[model samples]
Target: MPRVIGIDIPDKKRLEIALTYIYGIGRSVSNDIIARLKLNPGMRAHELTQDDIAKINTLLQNEYVVEGDLRRQVQNNIKRLVSIHAYRGSRHRAGLPVRGQRTRTNSRTRKGKRRTIANKKK
Candidate 1:
């Protein structure tokens, strides 16, 4: 495992993919970072060296908000929506999908397990 941006990336994953394990970084951002740092995207996570980590950190600081800062910014955006009573906010508050996905039968993953009524005995 190699630690970068406070994340421990698995050695088997490609460097670009492993980079996505950090919050606020996705495939696109990982590609951008690798390009900026002149890193080989095909490299394995375990092959990353100290200077690579430093280069990544520098690139992120210059061009992106990441990890804790990004999380807080997203949380604040949701909080603001809730404060203003938006429909999306209400949906979020109710723990339902905010974008109107059908929930009648498919939201169990988010809504958790359903309870059942007991059968009567003779």
Candidate 2:
């Protein structure tokens, strides 16, 4: 495993794919990073030289919000929305889907396990 920005990336995977293990970096962004740094995307993560690692770290720190910072930024945005009492924010606060997803049947992921209501005997 190779450590990048404090995250351990799988050494057996190609550099391009391995880079995506880091938060906020997907395939496209990983490819772009490889291209900008002139790195061999086909090379395994373990093959990265110290200079390459340094360049990657510098580029990520200067040009991108990632990892802990990205997570914190997202949380802050949600908090702001909640403070303003936005509709979407209310959904988030309620632990429901926020993207207009139907909750009638398909939102078990957000709604959790079903709670049964017992019948009352007269």
Candidate 3:
């Protein structure tokens, strides 16, 4: 494993793919970082030199919100929405789909297991 910004990226993967292991970095961001830093995307993470790792660390720290910082920022956004009583926030608070998915029948994943209601016989 190679450590990048305190996160251990898999050593066997290509540098571009391995970079995605870091929080807030995805395939596109990884490609963009490699392109911007002029690093070889095909190189394995384990093959990175000390200087290359240093450059990546520096670049991420200076230009990106990642890892704990990114997590905190997202949490803060959710909290802000909830505090403001937004519709999305209410959905989140109710543990339901936040993106307007119909919950009448197909939202079992979000609404959890069905509870049977017993009917009284006349």
Give the best candidate by TM-score: 2
Misplaced by over 4 Å in model 3 are: 113-122
**How badly does each model clash, as a count of residue pairs?**
0, 0, 0
Better of 2 and 3 by TM-score: 2
Pick by TM-score: 1 or 2, better one: 2
Return the clash pairs for model 1, or none.
Answer: none
Model 3 vs. true fold: TM? 0.88
- Candidates, ranked, lDDT: 2, 3, 1
Q: What TM-scores do the predictions have? A: 0.87, 0.93, 0.88
Which pairs of residues collide in model 2? none
TM-score of 2: 0.93
| Lowest lDDT block of 10, candidate 3 | 113-122
- Runs off by more than 4 Å, candidate 1: 117-122
Worst 10 residues of 2 by lDDT: 113-122
Which sequence of candidate numbers ranks them by TM-score, best first?
A: 2, 3, 1
Output candidate 2 Cα RMSD: 3.1
